[model samples]
Target: MKRSLIIANRLREVLLNGHWIANTNCKEQILSVNWMQATQKVGNLNMIAALTFHINYYLVGLLTAFETGKLEISDKFSFDLPPISSESEWNKMVTDFISNSEKFADKVEQMEDSLLDQPFIDEKYGTFLRNIEGVIEHSYYHLGQISLIKKLIMQDQS
Candidate 1:
């Protein structure tokens, strides 16, 4: 019933579980692909592995800010996904993404509802709710791309 819980649920609906919106969450989509499928390039679009790393990058940075009260993430480096050359490496990245998603939701869930209105790191960045909601919207945008990319890759292979 609390606002924090509601926002956290939205985060889960997009990232972890709940199929009310897009019919697929990030966890389900990312987990559906193997290393080869994930790394497969489809024209000029970003690969699935790169997108996964991008989302996880923000999750990790936001979690860090939640813990330390400092926001230190940049858009330029968000897609700087390290080489995922092997299945084990891909799996490690997937594991970290899932772990960070849960941690991000948990941190948001535990916050006092009023905290959502407070500035995230500073007044220039807007409120906590704005950033969290931005993540959800941004994720869905990329999720749509991931879905399309996966379908394209599968079609190409067929």
Candidate 2:
């Protein structure tokens, strides 16, 4: 399988099915059976819901860049990503993120393997694959953070 396509598929499985977990935390650990209460943000730093949304945002952007040949990372940081401050807003954002990501990955899966190395100039990052790799690494890194933060949030609530 192509590296880009493999990464794309792996990421989807990770995001949705708990396959590429990248961290020690399990699915049950990150999610409360009652996910609604778990969506509440307890402090200035984004809670589990906001962090989850931010993860999906980067994935969506990465896949979009790959398909369109225009790479750009968002200005927002996980700590400051638009707050999932409300349950309704958080739900929509998370749901849309997931939907966009699945669509984006489908686009990536159609590309030739050699295309991954082809250059696309981004005003911020210089090349396409460089930016794509960043997205992959960043997603896994934040998945780690999400796992850790979710644990903390659950512990406090419990």
* Candidate 2 lDDT, 14-57, residue by residue in tens: 55454535533223334442345446555665566656666666
Q: Model 2 compared with the native: what TM-score?
A: 0.70
Model 2 has an lDDT value of 0.59
lDDT of each: 0.93, 0.59
lDDT of 1 at 12: 94
Q: Superposing all C-alpha atoms, what RMSD in Å does each candidate have to the true structure? A: 0.7, 3.8
Candidate 1, number of clashes: 0
Candidate 1 C-alpha lDDT tens digits along 1-158: 99999999999999999689999999999999999999998889999999999999999999999889998899999999888889999999999999999999999999999999999899999999999999999999999999999999989989
Stretches of candidate 2 off by over 4 Å are 20-45, 63-86, 122-127
